[model samples]
Target: MDERKYNMAEEVKVFSTWSSPFALRVIWALKLKGVEFDTIHEDLSSKSPLLLQYNPIHKMVPVLVHNGKVICESLVILEYIDETWKQSPLLPEDPHQKANARFWAKFGDDKVSSIWSDVLMKEGKEQEEGVSASMENLKYLEEEIRGKKFFGGETIGLADIALGWLAYHLVIFEETLGLKLIDQEKFPSLAAWEQEFANAPIIRENWPDRDKLANLFGVLREANLGKGTPK
Candidate 1:
């Protein structure tokens, strides 16, 4: 544990949006590490000046400010948190396993956004294509966690935190869109893992408001696709 690197007295702030999965990733990581930090929720419609200043390039939430230095991007922040606070290890101790965890975390990051936009946001033919692609991507993940309780084995880890959206928010997406993307029959392991992940103590405690998220997604889907709310 390198406590010197992360000054306990200095400010540790997380600029994030409540509905953002990326932001939730940081929140989970911080909670898992038992790091005390202040959360500043940003209104994505009109981002805050602090968010812009901290993450000039992305201009997005989940910007972690430690002391005075800023770390943007959820995965990067997770890594920074893990490195800075080594109490509850987020990554595997073995180098090979750690690399594998990073790989899947990156995979989840790369694929989840597209899945949300294409599958959840779009409709008709586009959404059908997105569903197929998402299933394929999820199949790969399913195999990765085929027998484990979580992507990080018995306990949650970096990859599990990275893909936490799948456990919590994806249900809201399904309800809002009235689509079943992660069926228990189709992706049994992944589906089972979802329940286990969401039921975890820290995750359950910090879970987002389901109805609020569903309503938000409903509005976003309508605005993005120019279609009335799904039945």
Candidate 2:
């Protein structure tokens, strides 16, 4: 009566969008577990029937369809993947340590989302305020990961997966906005962590194309803030 065992005949499919950090979390988690899964690239503007059927409430990408069962939300999917596969453990063994990892993961999601909605989408004073808030969030994380190579420890783990966007996508934000959000002087530790995270073999291989992300963010910034016209 092993909960982790699944029939080999069952299909493992992930409905995801290429540019979504949320979907990337699922991809990273599955890859870390060495779980082979088929990916279905989804168009968020006009989502597919399968995505809608699998995730009726949110109908978002990163919907993991295991056999016929569906799991939504990136963090939830990460935990499920970890539990299902015992290799390359994502969460710590100790209960207290596990809770700490979960806490940081949740914090990373909140801060990243805030930067998107408040900083990237706003202008002038409001954007300035958002930047300040984002800095504070990064500072807290910088202090947390000062001694450790990664959030969970020496190896990539749940918190690292949660904060993966900061390592790659944050550059797109800085480039598109023409502002320095996480600089060496301000967030030295977090800046270093970004490099380390991006350079990891698995992450380096799977990271989204930089030029494409830059173009996408540039278009999004123009649409939201009416900044430089998107090329």
Candidate 3:
């Protein structure tokens, strides 16, 4: 009759790298769910055997091993967690709402990385296009979250977790690139939502150190600039 005994049967292992936005996606989901997990930090420079074994395709970190079964791809892993544990609901019960949330999540996932390219590597037309795309994506998000506290509507859900990568990781790009994509006056809704997200204890406590993340961005930017990979 003890719930604690039942909880012990469900355990998870997360393999992640420190500087990966994709890895942070899984971390935020786990933290939001209040799920106790064993975290193994992987050195991306030298791939771990365990990581390679779990994710033979991409072999990337942010691999969630639940009850000995491995789930890769941060978004997919999040869906798996939500389906497995219903304690802290990450997705909506309504099918329509869930679909809408997934749309925004996909938008952010696909377009947000381009902002990094804009900030770090490309110049001239390529950089301009990246900036334009980033702005358009933010505009869509602002419209979507106009009256809602979170992307999933009212409560922090999977979409919020997916887009939360921007909350911390973007500051560095903003600084390094000298771009201010989110203007409070221009996008008041998003600005307010960002504050709400940061104030949330789960998110606040889990964010990467700003200075450190910024330094990493600087290094990556320099490398990408040299290689001309921004486009």
- In terms of lDDT, the best-performing candidate is 1
Q: What is the lDDT of residue 94 in candidate 1?
A: 99
Query: Native-vs-model 3 lDDT?
Result: 0.81
Q: What lDDT would each prediction earn against the true structure?
A: 0.88, 0.87, 0.81
TM-score attained by model 2 = 0.92
Most accurate candidate by TM-score: 1
Residues 60-132, model 2: lDDT tens digits: 9889988777899999999988997888999999999999999999998876569998888888899999988
lDDT of 1 by residue, 1-231 (tens): 455455467689999888889999999998888888899989988898888999999999889999899999999999999998888899989999999999999999788657888887778898899988998898899899998998999889999999988987988788777778788998899999999999989898888788888888888788777666543
Candidate 1: the clashing residue pairs are: none
Q: Give the CA lDDT, 0 to 100, for residue 216 in model 3.
A: 78
CA error at residue 220 for candidate 1, angstroms: 0.6
Which clashing pairs does model 3 show? none
Segments in model 2 whose C-alpha atoms lie over 4 Å from true places: 1-10, 226-231
> Could you tell me which 10 consecutive residues in candidate 1 have the lowest summed lDDT?
1-10
